[model samples]
Structure formats: structure tokens, C-alpha cells
Target: MIVAPGACRRLKPPYPYGSISISFGETLFNIRTDNFILGLTFLAPLAILFLNILLVFKVRRILFERKMNSSKKQRKSHISLTLTTLAIMIQHLASGAKTVIGIVRPELVPYALIIRHRLIDLGMISVPWIFYISHPMFHEKTARVSSFT
Candidate 1:
């Protein structure tokens, strides 16, 4: 449907829809109704973000209560895991970026996708490393049950 400031004409049903590929060189007047699904993409992230805030607060509260009773290693590991979970949840928001890819600067679609990919990839790839670095368990050497030398 081509829409002006105050008017819009619904495209007839021979081929009534547009796609992101077709929308690339076109202007905003070249409208489509498929944006609803795109809007749905952000819902998961929004819910996760809300849950993440709650989880962070709960973990902090628990850590505060157990501060003196828990060993330093236990406290450190708990904090490390909570922070990692929060970071990963934040990274999930980038998955929604594709919904707005060509809407605001159509020319930068490629760059936007690249940046989004990098952000998501960096977050996913760093998770194990973050755990390894933050938790001392990964750094510990296991006692040999059988001599391998």
C-alpha cells in the first residue's frame, strides 16, 4: 500500500505484499503489513530483561545475607555467575535489531547486520571465557587417580 500524509491505498491481491529485499530501495510510502511479526521479535527480550533485573536484585540480596557465612570462593563464584547471566541477557537484545534494519537507514542495513552479528557473536563466544576467568574451579588441577607419566 502506498501511503501519503493522510491517505493510504491497499494494494490489491495479485501480489499484495512487499518484502525487506523489495523495500531496500523504496521509500516509506511503500508500506506492508508484515511488521507485526517483526514487532513480536522484541517481546522475548523485553521479558528477559525484566526477569534479569529481578534475578540480579535477588542474587545481590542473597549474597548480602550470606556474606559472612559463605566462604570467599563461594561468594565470588555466585557473583561471577550472576554477572555473566546478566551480560548474556543484555546481549540477547541485539537479536531484535534485525526488525529495524531497513526501517531507519536502509542504506546501512549491511552494516547494521554486521554490527549485530558481531555483538551477538562476541557475547556468545565470551561466555565460556568469562566463566573460566571468573571461577577458580576451572583453574584448579585435579589430583591424579592413576599415574600417566
Candidate 2:
């Protein structure tokens, strides 16, 4: 289905209470809600950010233990993946905080805008790195399994 510019693709049922949409320039940033689910949506990214941190830690440990054993190509890939994970996690956390603060305080909208713009940039750059990391990890895991078999 096609969605028009500035229109949300998902249709949410309206609550008995009124809700507002937060907009910056042409884009609708978020929909304000008194409902718990909406509040959870604002907080969900924070949880993902934490997960990313955990993955980074795990990846770092692997890299550290294998530093001497792994080839230059593998080590470089690990470094790039870890750094990208870290940067994305930071960007997600900051953006989530900005969104929560914006909704709760409404006065921090400007700060939220700055955070949103930064996230947009981070998303553009980090998505490719995520795939980069995943592709190698997938192949490595497959190779290990095949050797075991």
C-alpha cells in the first residue's frame, strides 16, 4: 500500500482521550499518547539500545580472545562492526531520551529535533554496517557448523 508524505502507515485506534502528533518541519516525529502502550513505544528503543550494548560486549570479548588467532581481514571487520554497534547504540539511546523528554516536557522540542536529525544520519550510515557485520557472522557460523558436521 502507498502512504502519502507525512502520513503514518499504521492506523491506531483513537483513545477516548485526545492525542497530539509531534512534528518537526515536514516530518511527523511521534504521536503523543496518554496510553501506556504509546509510552512503551517511546521507551522501547532504550531497550534495543541496551541489547546492542550487550551484543557489542560479546563481540568485543570474541575479538579480544581471538586477536592473535584471527587474520587481519577478520580483525579489521570485527573492529569496524564493534565500533558501528557502539555508535548506533549511543545514537539510539540519545534519540530515545530526546523523544521521551520531548513528550513529557514539551519544552525540550528543539533538543529533540537535534537528536532526531542526528538519528536520521546515524540510521543512514549504520544500516549498511549492520549488514556488513551480519554477513560475515553468518558465513563464519555456517563454516563452523559445516566443519563440525
The lDDT of each candidate is 0.69, 0.66
TM-score of each: 0.62, 0.55
Candidate 2 local lDDT, 82-110, one digit each (tens): 77777676667766777778778876666
Provide backbone clash counts, one per model: 0, 0
- Tens-digit lDDT track of model 1 for 47-86: 7777888888888998999999998888878888787876
Candidate 1 lowest-lDDT run of ten: 18-27
Off by over 4 Å in 2: 1-34, 126-149
Ten residues in sequence with the least summed lDDT for candidate 2? 1-10
